[model samples]
Target: MVVLVPVTSVNWREVTRVRAAEHQRRWVADVTYYLCLSAYDGLWRSCAVQDEDSATVGHVMWAVDPEDDSHWIGGLVIDAAHQGKGFGRATVLALMTLWEHEEPSLSGTPYAQAALSVAPDNRGALGLYRSLGFVETGELSDDEVVLRRGRPAQAPLRGSG
Candidate 1:
């Protein structure tokens, strides 16, 4: 079984191992470490996707928008060795479930929405997001495309089990 666990209580060394193995540079691994630390500071939140054996296979990061306090998924990374194995899809789904159950502030910000940007050339990720009900919002950067999925769009698919 796959499990999504809060980054707050996870072991970073394990996460670093997976990241270092997948990414080309130690910089990527270092950035992941700092990102989790920043998230734990309560300025943001992140999680790790682990297998039944407790091995971390992926990670997702998000932060509450300061202007609106709406949660925005900042990054997602599944270990290269684990790609094409459905873990990426499962991880995003789990994150969405967690987001939906979370309460919004009294400001009536709706349930907020989760968004992510992927490289335009990343057909696998684009297809996975679309299959999971995320719609293309626009371009996020010079080479990245943005996708968004709100709570309403998320409801009908809850039975995807």
Candidate 2:
């Protein structure tokens, strides 16, 4: 029963409390940084991942690329103590579930796919994303390998003139 609570001025304190394991810190930055991103970018949204008991288990954020009109999920961090409990998978699935229903403002259509990047060496995350259908796109972002899931974006229908 994992749930996502959008990070807000009222809940940022609780969201910031979620942290990754010491070693996993290299893969993700502090939650505060992600929250700051959301504050500065209207297109970016961050959320706190909570378990059935309502305890904060992790944090994740997503954004729609204005250039490509693609949905991108990033800044996923499961608290040090909450790892190996499937919260990571749940959070991602929860995000997909949300997007599956909403129309992107630019496209006026449901999100066709989602993209994310990962450090090539982060085996755990790579495994998680791969298991959930993300495939390598032979692309890189900030030196991280890019992967995407769902159907590729389709060209807009041209009015038959």
Candidate 3:
């Protein structure tokens, strides 16, 4: 069984250790943990996936923008040992559900739209996102491709007279 745990209560060192072991590329592991910490500080939301044994196998960070009310999935990382076990997709879906349930005003805005950027070479991640209803949005940087999920347009205004 996979479980999502709040980053606030998690040990970053442990997470970094696991990631370093799993990711063969030292830079990837380092960057993943760095982004994880940055997201926690900026968004106040980060999560890690724990297996049945309670070991963290993956992590993700997300937040809702205060100004435009847009939701952003900043980063996702699955330990190499836990990769290809469906944890990545499961964790993302779980986070989306949580976002959907949050109050729109306090959370900024709850629209059917969630955005994320992934390396163009990450076919596995692209496939997973596509399977989960995320589509390419034609927005790209030199190294990353931007994707979006949920309803195509902004949701109807809520609580408006």
Candidate 4:
């Protein structure tokens, strides 16, 4: 089973070692760049994607957007050797579940949805996200297409007659 382990000083080195394949290098930044970002960006949190044996297989990070209270996932890089083994999907799903149940935010406001940005040409990632219910928002960040998966609709309360 894949688990998202919070990055700490003890494991930061292992997390930084996670890297992407040459072709995917264009889509995500180096793990160190993200680690440095989390250092200054208080809202951002980084995690190491570990496998059943607790060995790091990838890296992912997220931040709660203060403006819209959206959980924005960024800097996801699955080690080239670990790609195609479902670690990417598992990591994303685990984060989504965490957001849904934990509602991470600075203002205590619940996140309306989970969001991510992908390069227009990253067909593999686009496909994976779309299949997981993330739809394009017709927006772009750093020239990457933005996508979001919203919470499922809740049933309305019935009025007593």
Candidate 5:
């Protein structure tokens, strides 16, 4: 019942309208996230979450940190009403698939890995990240607990010489 839609294909006003107690201001959330990441000159991509009825229910953001060949996933949010319906797990799997197999392009930037951070007190989030193989990096940004997930680039198979 949940799927990812390009942010461009949806209306920001509707996405952030707080149509129900479960909804929140996505536009403002993105704006705030961007401000904090202003120091990074990387490519940012956002996807909107759609419900069975195609209503905007949540949002996710990920980007490439070209400086380090590292990718980042953030802003993984779901509506309060939709909180325990497996949407969160689905959204995350969708993101991992996006980064691992899709090879998202941004002009000429290349990324070989990805990372994320979550609030330490958010046990659900911590468990989710760990279940997906993410581990604590002992790194903190502001009050967030940073975690990383990815593998070293694989060498190309050499022709049988």
Candidate 6:
């Protein structure tokens, strides 16, 4: 069992240390980079993916594209040592489930759509995202493939019924 815990609640030093070596290509450079991004919008919520033991085995974040108003998954990193243990898949599934039903908001307004970018050669990530209903858009970011999933359907407004 994995859970996404608020970043502030975890030992961030350890979370950022969940990194692969310089020779090993990884999605995120370090968690500290993301923590620095906190200088900006509330659109981004940094979270640690904790295992049943409550150990921080991975990291994930959801940020709204301020320009397009679409929500995107960013900085998903599972420690290489913990890779292949299903942490990535499980955490990702939980993340999608969270955003899909939660009616994501940015600056107090509804934020929708789903997007993520994966490097073309990153088969592991492609496979995982594909399994979770993400598809390539043929759009590239610094050579990374952009994928999108529709936001989960929102429940009806209470009084609008």
The model with the greatest lDDT is 4
Give one digit per residue, the lDDT tens place, for model 1 in 1-161: 46877666446556654553433332233446646555557665656779778888877676666774555665567777877678878887776666676555322345567677777776766888899888898647456787877766544566586
- The per-prediction CA RMSD against the true structure, in angstroms, equals 5.3, 4.8, 4.7, 2.6, 4.9, 3.5
lDDT by residue (tens digit), candidate 3, 8-127: 544665566445234335324453455555665676466667778888887777777675566777557777777777887878877777676664753656665788877877777788
Please identify model 3 stretches exceeding 4 Å from their true place. 20-32, 35-41, 103-106, 151-161
lDDT of 6 by residue, 1-161 (tens): 79988687436776777775354455556767776665365567877888999988987887777788667788888887888789988987777667655654423436456789998888878988998889898898787999998765678998996
Q: What is the lDDT of residue 27 in candidate 6?
A: 54
Candidate 6: lDDT over CA atoms?
Answer: 0.76
TM-score of 3: 0.74
lDDT of each: 0.66, 0.87, 0.69, 0.88, 0.66, 0.76
lDDT per residue for candidate 4 within 1-161, as digits (tens), equals 68888899899999988889999887788999999888887778888999999999998999878778788999889999998999999999988777777764533768678899999999999999999999999999889999999987766779843
User: What residue runs in model 1 are displaced by over 4 Å at the alpha carbon?
Assistant: 20-42, 105-110, 139-143, 153-161
Instruction: Give the Å error, residue 158, model 5.
Output: 14
Colliding residue pairs in candidate 3: none
Residue 55's lDDT within candidate 5 is: 80
Weakest ten-residue segment in model 6 by summed lDDT = 103-112
Per-candidate clash tally: 0, 0, 0, 0, 0, 0
In the range 50-123, model 2's lDDT, one tens digit per residue, is 99998888899998877776789989999989998899999999888778755655335458779999999999
The lDDT, on a scale of 0 to 1, for candidate 4 is 0.88
